[model samples]
Target: MNTKLKHLVRKIRKNSTAAENILWKELRNKRQGSTFRKQHSFPSYVVAFYCYEKRIIVEIDDQIRTPRSLYNHAREKQLTREGFIILRFTNVEICRDLESVMKKIREKL
Candidate 1:
């Protein structure tokens, strides 16, 4: 990653949302039986959480809109083509019932 991208990643990690922070606690430090990185930056995109060992990328969508939805679909297709399994959850799901979200991630694992 370039310096600008690295700085952007750091800024994101520093200003994470409540849901991201909650999920990060569970994904950090191999707590989920595998290593994961927060605000992981790829050459073209930055994902919420990524498990390189499993090629899994967890995305927390804060909102649903036409443009964002389209962008996410395209991004998902590209990432899937690269052999990644994308797991997306909403802020409500993360805060309302985190265990279910974790269960889904574990199932993927």
Candidate 2:
């Protein structure tokens, strides 16, 4: 990764959302079979969580700005085309239905 992206990743990691922290607690320590990296930075973009063995990226979709929706849609399409499986969870979804989220992730794995 480039120096700028690396720095951005560090900043993001340090300033995680409450939902991210809650999910991280469950996803850490290889509890789901393989280790997951939080705030992982790739050449294309930075992901909230990633598991290399499962080729899955988990994103907390709390923000709902319309201006970025088109861009996010394109990014999602490109990531899928490149063979990456993405799991998106809203803040409410994670906070209220964590078990269901974990179940879905386990199924993906």
Candidate 3:
């Protein structure tokens, strides 16, 4: 990541959405048996959360179906091509049923 992207990542980390904050409580500090970085930047994308050791990227989408949108489809393809698994959960899902969300992430790890 370039300096600009690093700054952007920092900005994002400071101003996290409610859902991101809620999930971060569980994902931070090796709470899940692996370290996860929030607002992790790639060359062209800033992932919601990333686990470098497991090559996993967890994304929190605003819309429930945004994961299937064209842009996300292409992004997911590129990330998977790079051998990263992308897990997507919507804001509603995170706020409503965090246990299920954590369950899925645990399964991935």
Candidate 4:
């Protein structure tokens, strides 16, 4: 990993959003025996959370202006090709209905 990328990841981990913090609480302690890394940096892009055991990437999508960005599509395609599952959740949805998000993650796991 590049020094710059590692720095950014550390910065993000320190300055996490409310939703990310809340979700981290649930994902911590190897929730369901699944260890999750927050602010994880992949070779292609930085992910909100990563589970190496299941090869899953969890992304909190807060920007609704574009719905989904070209960058995200490209990133998703690349991750898919790499055989990793990508899970995306809106910030509002996560804040309002976290149990549902957790349920989805459990199903994926």
The best candidate by lDDT is: 3
Q: What is the C-alpha lDDT of each candidate?
A: 0.91, 0.86, 0.92, 0.87
RMSD over all Cα atoms, model 1: 1.9
TM-score of each: 0.92, 0.91, 0.90, 0.92
Candidate 2 local lDDT, 28-105, one digit each (tens): 999998889998877878888999988898888876423237766887788889899999888888999999999999
Single out the weakest 10-residue window by summed lDDT for candidate 2: 63-72
Residue 39 of model 1 has an lDDT of 88
- Over 35-102, each residue of candidate 4 has an lDDT whose tens digit, in order, gives 99888888758998989999999988775424468988988899989999999988787899999999
Candidate 4 or 2, higher TM-score: 4
Candidate 2 RMSD to the correct structure: 1.9
How does candidate 2 score on lDDT?
0.86
Candidate 1 runs further than 4 Å off: 64-68
Which pairs of residues have clashing backbones in candidate 2?
none
TM-score of 2: 0.91
Q: Give the TM-score of candidate 3.
A: 0.90
Q: Against the true structure, what is every candidate's RMSD?
A: 1.9, 1.9, 2.0, 1.6
**Displacement of the residue 7 alpha carbon in candidate 1, Å:** 2.3
